[model samples]
Target: MGLVERTSSRCAGRAKAFKSPGAWHAAGFLAEADLSANAIERARRAAPAYIDLTSSNPTHQGLIFPVEMLRAAAEPYWFARRYEPDARGLLAAREAISRYYSGRTPALLVPPDQIVITASTSEAYGLLFTLLADPGDNFLAPNVAYPLFEHLAAAHHVTLRSYQLDESCGWQIDEATLLRAADARTRGVLIVSPHNPTGMIVQQPIAALERLGLPVICDEVFAEFTYRAPHTPPLAALHPALPVFTLNGISKMFALPDLKLGWIAMNVPAASAFGARLEILNDIYLGANSLTQAMLPALFEHGLAFTAAMRQRIRASLDAALAVLKGCPALQVRPPDGGYYLFPRVMCQDDEEALVLKLLERGVLVHPGFFYGCEDGTHIMISCLSAPEVLVRGLELIVETLTT
Candidate 1:
């Protein structure tokens, strides 16, 4: 049997065996492998310290939070503690998000009613997958995207098809690859501006996708952290006629991942049809807590200083990493336009996973290319979100491994 058939049969067997509560796992995503973490844990127990090049959490990387401001923002929720759940979200929070979008180019005037708040962008993806597709319908995404999409689609019983991102063209969307991947069962197309790992801003062919009549789901969580070029413009602004759902959150935007808040800015004529149904979906879990919703306005306004500091830190880290890697001839590094990752192609004969394990043994932890669905060659992604000293040390170890 083919992959789909095999996966379906396996899912059927699993469903029968467990009296299947949800069968979300049997949807045939990658196994929940913790091999990288396992390797890192073993190395750490045996050694004094390991320079983790895969560090993406901003809070752990030494970002100072405005504790007073954040505390004050959430204080109001406690004063008026009552369950006033609006299936869409608190209007005030949505209004705050709308105001945030009002500052975008072309002035994306997203009404508070059009916004659907969720616990995280990952939740937003689940909502969208269910809203746009029936089971067995698929969405096309970039081959080099973050792995979360695979899990999200699998959870919703949706298949994810990956189109190519032309690495030769600064990882722009490969239209031919995309066209070949889609069919009548394709429900939507997912794009990530300042894409994770590769940090490539999507210059989507809006006119072509408009013809395909598929809604465009653009994840712009890292839209603000540009170095080589201007920040990526809102994908919704570029193509107003096309059905667009722009996903962003306080996670990457304000370095507040633990805040657990995200929203979808809907910008299309057909969005109205989705509103009531989307509200029903949001109501099912009501995953977003009112405390963060209460804090969002102040967080958005006051968190600028924190985000500014982080952007500076990431840029500096990238420059420092590039400077060190310049001396290492075996690895090729392309500085990303945005995002906190540096994915470098490694010149090594060993399998990527084995190389990752070897690097772990050498007291540095980094992600192998295959971890992010990279099949082109031996590549590994390191985070530029680490502290400068830690990042420099990690890169030095990586260089030693590559050259030796």
Candidate 2:
């Protein structure tokens, strides 16, 4: 067999053995940063260490929260007394979201009907997936964006294809590339605002997707954590006629992921047929973890302040990471638009796996860019919110390894 065929044939057997797309064969897995998983697991086996630079998790790294405040947010919900909010969500929680969005985009109110509460955005995506695309239909997405959608798509049994996001333009969407990526089989286009890892946002790429007459699934979980632009309204506001499913949750927004609260808001103002289907899907799932939904009103009013504080801390962390990158000649970090991580190319002798493995040995853990669907593996991602001191030290060790 030829080299390419031989490589594929060889890798195919190994690929089938992995649980789901993991670092090994990377076949069936979903979106996860196994860096910590790799570190903690391998550390027990080996115990070489330094600091971890790869984590976006709020709790483990300690983002500095008011424990009492978080406790109080869930307190009222505990008194539940058997009150469920129409399986849609409580009016009080919805109104708080409405008020927040209204302030963010005063020109319009997203009409709380547009929002359906879920236990998490993952559920929101699943709802949208079930509502629009059938099993095996293809979804077009950015070539270099978050990997979580891949896992979700796999679970939903939807095929995913990619269009390029121009790396040179601060990761802007390429309208032509998107057009080329979609066909009749394509059910939807998914976009992550201030995308994960790369941290860039697709500010001006939807016009093409709209032309195709396909629905758009916008994951705005990181919508509130922007750096360059003022918060943009959910895509529903831009093209009211287009069928759009906007997903967001408290996981990243408020840094209260432990709360297990999330939501899917359907914005198909122009397509009532599509809206009806989505509503039914929500009904099928009912509501996720009632107590978490119960905590929403309190979270909106009180926990939000903690989120604002976390954003400030994230900015500081981003600046520190950028500053460190300046000194590391072998590394180049692309400025992210609004997420909590930076994806940069690490100077590697071959692939980043060695560097990643080396970093783990040193106690500093991080994810290789290959984990996020980059065709090439020169990239490594570092969480922008890894505590200030730890991030600095981690960067120092990473730079040290690259140069030496």
Candidate 3:
């Protein structure tokens, strides 16, 4: 027999009689699995119909793109002529990234040496998680942050503890709460600026959080798209005194998630030991794509115009969505300072999953607030990057449902 089979056979006797409930094993261990499987099966069988507000992809959501620009983006690189970046990514690509950042915040002064491009922000997270914490060490995250980090943290064996982001103040992380969350085991803090789902910049609080003696992993993928305030300086610029691993990618910046281009720029004080250790970790992985790195110089120079126009289109859609949502008094939107999303709390005691299922039944796909680690109440996250007509129609339907 296989190891599992043999172990199961050996443990089948009378141990349960002597064991505490927690210490019970063998067939009883398998009993929990059986019960869980049955519960999941029953829930699936009993699922309610719904219109989902969970769609995020602009491409799939019927947004128009410059077809010619897209066609050109796919013209394959001359692989024979292309090769790996110098372990730190190509200098030209880094220069292009520097130019991109410099154009927005001249005061930020992003150095080419500080940037290490990855294929996606997810990879950047994996890299930074491994760099900042040993297995079993902790990173503090915003309570209602994106849920992807749970899987990312698991892969690196890093524990993530949630700190409340005050929803009363449009869901910005309260500085005091963050400071309380930090301890000797806390190696880093991850904040999503123009945060995912909630879409608000933690402007005033970011500085205070930085004062705590831990590295910061700021995900600013949505920096280019904001609905309020003159765009705050990217967090990389905000705290050069502390170690900051700032991540952004072509996915959100250029609306080019297909290109698989993301990067992490190390903005820690150059003298810090963390800075040296991260470089060694980056050198070991060398995870960047060379051809995409090669594409950066021309894309940043030319693509900035495309991105600027896209930003305008998204803002128009955001305005349209807010207006529609405002008409529905039962649903209140949390105004976003920057980002391609909005979080709207609706008048429903029913869990977000139930509400999302209700919407999905109406042929709308939306993300429920609970999906974003929200525990307190029901909410829905809708993408502002959708085509304007769909945004309008979706909100009308939402209003109709809320009123009736």
The lDDT leader among the candidates is 1
Candidate 3 segments whose C-alpha is farther than 4 A from its true place: 1-52, 62-84, 205-207, 268-272
What lDDT score is found at residue 117 in candidate 3?
Answer: 72
Superior by lDDT: candidate 1 or candidate 2:
1
lDDT of 2 by residue, 1-404 (tens): 11111111101111122255547555434333232333233442465446767666788778755878768877876666585545567667767676767766524465677667787887888777777788778888888755566667767878777888776677788889999988778998888886887887655436886788788888888887877666655666776677777778888887877777777666545236575666677777675676777667777788778888888888898888888888887886777778888888766456555667777776677776665666554788788788899998888888787777
What is the C-alpha local distance difference test score of each model? 0.79, 0.70, 0.70
lDDT for model 2, please. 0.70
User: In model 2, which runs have C-alpha deviations exceeding 4 angstroms?
Assistant: 1-45, 78-80, 105-108, 268-271, 347-349
Comparing candidate 1 with candidate 3, which one achieves the higher TM-score?
1
Question: What's the candidate order when arranged by decreasing TM-score?
Answer: 1, 2, 3
Our tally of clashes for model 3 stands at 20
Model 2, residue 166: what's the lDDT? 72
Backbone clash pairs for candidate 1 read none
Model 2 clashing residue pairs (backbone) = 20-28, 20-29, 21-28, 21-29, 49-362, 49-363, 50-362, 50-363, 199-337
Clashes of each: 0, 9, 20
Q: Give lDDT: candidate 2, residue 324.
A: 81
lDDT of 1 by residue, 1-404 (tens): 11211221111221112233356763343443221334334444577668878767788888757789888888888889998888888898999999989986447888998999999998999999999999888899888766677667767878888789877787778888888888889999999988888988754445657667788899999987887756678888888887889999988888888989999889855476577788898999999998999889888788878888888888998899999999998887888888889888887545776787788888898877665767788888899988999999988998898788
